[model samples]
Target: MQGISMSNTMQRRQFSVLACVFQSIFVALFAIFGEFHNHEEDKHNRVHANYPMFQDIHTMINDAGRSLVVHCFGAYFGLAAAKVCHRQNTMVVDDDESSGHSSELFAMLAKAACTTATFMLSSLADHLGRFNMAHIQSSSLAGGIAIGAFANVILYPHHAIVVGAAAALISVVGHPKILEKRLSIQDTCGAHSLHGLPSLLAGFLSALFVLLYEPSEYGPNFVEQYSAIYPQWKGSGQPGAHRDLRTQSFFQLAGLGLTFLTAIFGGLFCGWVMNWSLLNQVQPKPSYEDASYYLNAEFSLFGNIDNSGHGLGSSNTSIHKCGRIDYRPLDIEAALRAVKRAGIGPDAIF
Candidate 1:
């Protein structure tokens, strides 16, 4: 069982990496398509005319891929953090069986619907001023995460659309307030809304879906569609087994619970590790800053300068460029005295 679990973990990681690669490819193709589609409009459009297709490509890639990929990584870690309880009679569900036209429809429609809804819901942030652009941009993708577990199970296209829109609205509007006011936790990246809460919601929805599934929805191949639930109705020459709905629901809830526990404890432990003195010594002074992480940092022209012809030079060392300051070493001192004489006071320098 341990080996089996390890195998599953490796497989899931590989699958996630593959999905990210595909998302990048899709972003490139769609960006080019959008660029061509707007070629004529670009010539006449003054607004964002300078924004080229490369920017659009990155926007599409980040908007579409980041939230989804993050949700997947969080969910995987959450599940791995806890032990899952399964009924003895429960059947194994093959992950590959879920690929079909329904899956495609779910992906495309959910993305479109979520994108539209997020735009509308983000206005709430402007009014409340509780969050910033990170929340607005990333939290909107919660719709995709909310429908993740049951994406294929949604039979009607309209239902998927509704789910996506509703999820986006809830995430963008609720996440910041809850994090700031209720939890007293400031999620700098809005990960709680973009990945965690939406995923939990998706798991609950998936459980509801299992309870509400009907044979009439999928027709003759319905049993095969959910062979993991009804083991006894195996199609073709496959061995038959059976699982009751009640047990299925219990297992689903158990999985969700385990994931929650795992995520909480795992996160706490990781945070503790990050805060340790040993780790802190090696890291940059200020946390969550890009300056320390950059391989080649460029200093801005601001500050670290003096007009006295002697200052920190281009070689990062002090140099007397014009030697004018050496002749008048007290030039600045005299100026400050003059300012005081003029009644501006010492605070004038500040």
Candidate 2:
């Protein structure tokens, strides 16, 4: 069966700004995250201090540079769209109608950048001998994120709508691979955040950029603009000014939180019956066949469990080889089932 493929709703140009914005945000979070990922590699018990804020600034700047190349593809895509006639090619149409073309263009650019991120991530993972699908689950939402976040942005009027149409056609050239991923919008690893975040952000920002950059040239009629919504928030219609930093920041936070919550719930709901799949929880099997037991016995020796229930070592204040060695059976199935039922599992010693 043929699969569904999604594109972020934003135009190419506007995507640039949003990619910049989101790049900044991703860097901040990843700085902290990267340190955590590498925490085990410390040289000594004294622990090396990690500078999150400084690291975030540096990481984001580097990520932005790489992402910029992807944004250029979006620009080319937008330019092509301006030559064609497609909804995705609003820039061409908006430019003609004197609507918000600048904003739309920026949004498109940002979306293109994110699209590039998705493709690059896929390719880089493989190039480095890593699984290409590491972010497959995250890609769908990533697509949506790009599209949705930029939804509020406006587009330009193209004297020739064919530009957008052509751009859409070209972008679709890679549709097959994206469709094959079998991702859902709500999945944390879904293209929503991975793609949706950038797509939407691009789309909305493009709308704003389209109008902001060339309001007199392509902004909507005064009546139409006011009727749409948030007159003061028409970031595109009014150029040379930025949205309140605080408000924009709040929205960004909300966007991240929304995704985080959705990811948590989606993962739980979709895999409710499954447990310990991520190894967050340690559970044992119902029965241990000799083959399986021997195979996994040594493996779980250092497995982490929340509760060991070893009774605080009250065994005559003496440590035996058995006591010292955390050689205990793990009830993987039961523990998993219990977690599914109550979100709680038995704690083990090892």
Candidate 3:
């Protein structure tokens, strides 16, 4: 992929941009995030004393970077796990099975194709002009991640492309906005589409692949090529010791179930811990940006700013009265409702 990119004049520019962006980001990240000497002991310590603003920018960058990192590594990890465990329970007859360079090349191709598909899917966000491009791009990689678990078993380049394209299509149709509007579920990060769905898809695909796999096509040593991870199945074995397709499929499904349960229960436990008073920071408001959270926002003239030079005060009364007209932008019906709720006469509001 690197060679192909460098060989193309048009792609070289993109490579240059990508290199610059990553280099700048990492340098900034090291300058910013590397400052935390200790977490529990030095709670009051500043992360980057030299660059106070670096922390702020770091937060924004992290917000974006987290999505990409999650998608990329998520696929790689899933694929690696699948490859290692592809023949987890199978006992193969003695034969040296090797993917050679094909395994590595397949992973590389999947990554490139998946990323390209994601970017293409994100372009639709511009067409709709509603969804966040980051969310769309991240979610679009669902197909690649799903395919990762069975990438080596996938056999052909065109098949991998189809899986990626299909996943991207699914992402677009099942994006957060669509789910929120249709199902009343507000998935903030589109994790279901990006990681959850893809992982599930991969599991199912792996099971199907195992069921349909023909050892005869690859030769007498074919069993060696698609064997399991367990040490018992590491080498040549009697036919009776080897597990069948049905068992392999069952294990694959079981693994997916285990993953699902772990995520669900783990998330629940983490949520409970995070909401605990000792661990909880201030509860975040809807649509409240990092600037607002960090108290870096400029005070709106219509909003309340106390004499202490603070940005926006947490005064509902002031917000209702002064900021309503400018910040909230009340319609006539809403204005009337507010008047009635406040027990103020229409004349007084006018």
The TM-score values for the models, in the order shown, are: 0.50, 0.25, 0.46
Clashing residue pair totals per candidate (backbone < 3 A)? 3, 115, 5
**Could you give candidate 1's per-residue lDDT for residues 87-148 as a string of tens digits?**
12222221222235665555555554336456445543453322234444576577777776
lDDT of each: 0.47, 0.33, 0.46
Measured with C-alpha atoms, the lDDT of residue 51 in candidate 1 is 24
Query: Model 2 over residues 279-342: C-alpha lDDT tens digits?
Result: 2232222122222323223223333432333322222333322212333344566346434444
Say which candidate scores most in TM-score: 1
Instruction: Let me know the TM-score candidate 2 reaches against the reference structure.
Output: 0.25
Q: How does candidate 3 fare on TM-score?
A: 0.46
RMSD of each: 22.5, 24.4, 22.1
Instruction: Kindly indicate the candidate among 2 and 3 with the higher lDDT.
Output: 3
lDDT of 2 at 287: 21
- Give the lowest summed-lDDT range of ten residues in model 1: 56-65
lDDT of 3 at 139: 58
Which model, 1 or 3, shows the larger lDDT?
1
